[model samples]
Target: MQDHQSGHQRLTLSDVQRPEYLANPYPLYHRLREHDPIYWDEEMHAWVLTRYTDVVAVLRDPRFSSAWGPVETAWMPEELRPQLEPALRAVSRQMLFLDPPDHSRLRGLVARAFTPRMVESLRPRVQRLVDELLDAVQDQGEMEFVADFAYPLPAIVIAEMLGVPPEDRSQFIVWTQDFGRLLDGGHLSFEELLTTLSGIADFLAYFRRQIAQRRTAPRDDLLQALILAEEQGDRLNEEELLGNCVLLLAAGHGTTTHLLGNGLYALLQHPEQLQLLRENPSLAPTAVMELLRYDSPVQLTSRRLTADVEWAGRRFKAGEEVLTVLGAANHDPEQFPDPDRLDLRRTDNRHVAFGHGPHFCLGAPLARLEAEVAFTTILRRLPQLCLATEQIERLPSLVFRGIKALPVTFASVLPATGATAAAED
Candidate 1:
């Protein structure tokens, strides 16, 4: 372990201690991706995997394990260890943290709900929500792109599908924020992690109560489907059900929020692309895919080696931890030409914004639908939208690339309480 105290290394561990790295890790990632595509982290006892070919390969390879791992002390400073450990353990309990067979089973449980047909069914309702939200912004003259638009939209949609009442939607916001915070991995304290764990515990307790209610009083909702699934012998015990519910809600809210935020931010940054989207509403789908490829919200993913294996001309021992820098890979010049520039019209954009292989995001259909509706509606309705502030703040999260606040000015808005702004900044 080199300089285990500060968690810093010259070029090896530069990202850990550099504040600039948190802002835009691309330059650092480029250095690591091009030079040391695979390097051992002595302090963390892990390998950093950063390259398009290597990342995509490892994600598809069955030898890497998302779940199997022995618990240990945190690789960071002692003070950060207590908080980091519990969050890691709790996250490991989710399906994202599971290996095959179990991963297949857990994923299959909610797979039907997010399929193309099911997600498509929500289109009319999604359009209505989009219209209602845009209607409110129609007269406001200014809108906080995140608060007034992106963040709340996905939560509402997912909550409706999950059988949560309209009034309780705010609670999901709290839980999702806490969930995102723990995974951010940049500025969280041990105490903050414990506090967030309490939030998760509270959410689980509520979910258990909801599950019992659904068991007795079945309704035409996804939660009911999950409950009745057990009666049909597709049993999901309390732990799995609760864990999966949290997983769905968090993923449902998090990624979609990023897709909308990142996509919209890209539009604001590039006016011609925004005009291109406005000129051809039919281009929304491709624009969304390009946005994902250009600046993925979830920047990277982590995996552990289950066996000794050779990859990209490097050998690794069993039980080694590896970090796959997906954001860097999506922008790899080898994969996408002139990767730094945003090409809304870019075809053949098969980037792994939702990941690849068996662990591919189950909620992809829903995410795509949500993003399509959100981005298209905004461009069609508020074509004159522009940034109110030149400076945009980002959440200090390495795993997800998203804006903390995005203030913008629009020409006008429609009358109603449908658009309420809650800019945290």
Candidate 2:
């Protein structure tokens, strides 16, 4: 990729998905902050807000909509909706795309299952799962972390949490990668769009079956809880129930999967921090914050104006959109000191990698718990861990960022059984 500069407008639309930008977007983000803080891009046709303060405001402001009306159908434009009504019904039920009474109600119901006690209760399970994943590859002395470990940890946890059968988890991975294109598909062709929608159709059908079984004989899992959840005379309708299950699976799985992959890559790049973390694996929780800030998995999210108005000293009309570059804000020098350096013990980390305000990720505590368990188990079990190869492929999407695979070599050791299980927290 060649660098070009033009009259204080040094960034270009092409830079958004360039290999160099994907590999190290922070430098480009820094350049944007210096040259054009709230610049508009002709490619996306959306205003790009890079400053941390400006980004947070849009995330919190009610005027900026999730614009979920289109999400119901995998974000198919108006022309395509008629042929894709099934998908529209399913995803619209997801809470990530909801607002007001619906978002509040769905969040209130799901919150019960994701509380501190609830998340803590699963720590042992998470630990055991991590150990099991490592045990499978412990003797190999090398493994692809993303495929072997990172991708499965939260996926299995969330699948079981929602009553998805163990045998079904593999299919979940395939479905997730396809359905996730709803948000960020850069210049996707019509054929590619249809392929994604077909996946969404399959996902809705799979969950519908599980949801039906729960209806007949409700289990004591998160999906059943969601089915039975009620709030202040409000209950999730059928569409709401199924759509949210779709939402939870996507939201619950994607972020943490990338966290481990992205976080481990960050650690491998910064040996000092890796050494510090290996020395005190208990520091994994705090370290997760810096990992999120350093290379956020969800790179950027957008909000559309609900009413014509001026914000951040700029004028905007209703229906316009503002894209918040979280990776850039996480690297904002004004908010974080030495923003580019990976500091494992940084205490002032308040990055919005999981987002902020009303739509703040409901599954944050669970993601954190899963990471803590994954890092500690990996560091404790795999000694002398080092990257097998420096070359890694990252998903080339506008909204999501993650490695496709991470090969690493580590000293082999006898598999250690998890300490006598602690009574549930």
Best by lDDT, which number?
Answer: 2
For each candidate, what is the lDDT? Answer: 0.76, 0.81
Task: Summarize candidate 1's per-residue lDDT along 1-425 as a digit string, tens digits.
Answer: 22222234355533633567666677777777666778776644578776788888899898988884665554545675554554445556678888878788877878888889888888877777777778877767888878777877888888889897756767887888888776654556767866777687767777778888887888898888777765666456555667777888888887888888888888989999999998897988898889988878888788878889987667888888788878888878888898888988999888988888888888888888888877876776774789988777776676888887888887764432222221111
Q: lDDT per residue, candidate 2, 1-86, as tens digits?
A: 12336665557544868988877777888877787788676667778888999999889989888756654445567776764676
Error of 1 at 338 (Å): 0.6
**Which sections of candidate 2 miss by over 4 Å?**
1-10, 70-83, 230-234, 417-425
Question: What are the TM-scores, per candidate, against the unseen true structure?
Answer: 0.88, 0.93
TM-score of 1: 0.88
How good is model 2 by TM-score?
0.93
Q: Whole-model lDDT, candidate 2? A: 0.81
* lDDT score of residue 393 within candidate 2: 88
RMSD of 2: 3.3
